[model samples]
Target: MEHAGKHALVTGGGSGIGKGIALALAHAGAEVTITGRRADTLATAAALHPRLNALEMDVTDEASVREGIAAAAALRGPVRICVANAGIAEGGPFAQTTLADWRHMMATNLDGAFLTFQAALATLGDDDAARMIVVSSIAGVRGLKNAIPYTVTKHGVIGLIRGLSEEYMRRPITFNALCPGYVDTAIVRGQLPGLMRRFDVDEQGAIDIIAKGNRHRRLLQVDETTGAAMWLCSDAARSVNGQTIEISGGQV
Candidate 1:
């Protein structure tokens, strides 16, 4: 219960890595607010634990983010642990990637994180020590073929965290990014169909095909990444700021 009485906000908490972190925080005694675009999904997640509160929030919409976060703070308290974990992954040839495709990734991956952290920071008090974490990808640190736009957005989030951590150096807040390899989440599951068609394989075969993207030749679990996120929010990590935690089962 290291986080007892602290208020935490996690964007995209309805499923995948986001849900894993939200559940971990709630179990650790934080009053966690789990937000997403789908109310039903959020509601189902909240029912898993009494400490979790469901909030309908669209991170890409300015008014929605500001007002949603304000309401969350009012209910749970100031967000002492903000995890901007909502993001979308898309890939295509750089030559064929349309402006709309690029902007869509930017809106959800980069802009969404910007809004979530900014709104959550507004709720903090001067004396409150807080942790603001951005969930990025290994692609952030290196380029990934056929996913130029996604790679750019992930890199952008890391930059955002670095700059924020420096700006708040004198404050009680720390900013950091978690860059995990291809995580086994809904996002990965959704890729199975596309991969199956491309490789003429079944579900498991498709998974194996994509797992090669990781240096370890396997997909990392959602909880594996959540462990790093939970640790970052703990008091011990107060000094670990403006850093990137890479969890790819090997050196990136």
Candidate 2:
């Protein structure tokens, strides 16, 4: 167990990329606390493995994150690894996007990461080794058409990681980001209906349009991203701080 006895916290750990990362860490012998707004989802994920625990938390809410992560640390010990993976992905034309949608995106993707990292760092001291990973997207590094709000929030997260990494340069803590493209997840499935309607095509046709966005013209599995996350947490990657690990089938 490479991570035996380590305490890892994964936000939005109930499903999608978060779930995969949580399971991987648990298998590596970390005491993982998976948090999400859905109690049922958290409970279900916890049921899947003995090392995974459930914590009901909303990243957008400062109080919930502060208290919930504190509680998690109390139960599982100080959080040595924090994965800010909870996010909402919705996209539309910039002019057509409402202010409310923009706020919602920023609240969850940008502000949420801010609060998550802030609270998680509170559980660690200067001498304690830790890793903080922000689950950004390919959009973070490059702009995506018709996804202004989502793109903006993602870019903001990358900025957050870069700044944090510099601030903590002398400390044992490291900050990094993972940017993946077109992962095979519930989030991607949900986009199919919209794509079909917008493109006037069948499901497979819409999927083809989406898959082409990846360099290899195929969907990425959750484990592909999980492996990169696991590497970020390893001692071998100690100097790889403030870097963006892009997994888009090829270089973006």
- Which of the numbered candidates is closest to the native, going by highest lDDT? 2
Ten-residue stretch with the least lDDT total in model 2: 122-131
Candidate 2 per-residue lDDT over residues 109-138, each given as its tens digit = 999999999999999867999999999999
lDDT per residue (tens digit) for residues 102-205 in model 1: 99999999999999988998998888899999999999999999999999999999999999998999998999999999889888999999889988999999
Looking at model 1, report the run of 10 residues with the lowest lDDT sum: 207-216
How far off is residue 204 in model 1, in Å? 2.1
Candidate 2: segments with Cα more than 4 A from true spot? none
**lDDT of model number 2:** 0.94
Q: For candidate 1, what is the lDDT?
A: 0.93
Per-prediction TM-score to the true structure, in the order listed:
0.98, 0.98
Candidate 1's TM-score reads 0.98
Residue pairs with backbone atoms closer than 3 Å in model 2 (clashes):
none
Clashing pairs in 1: none
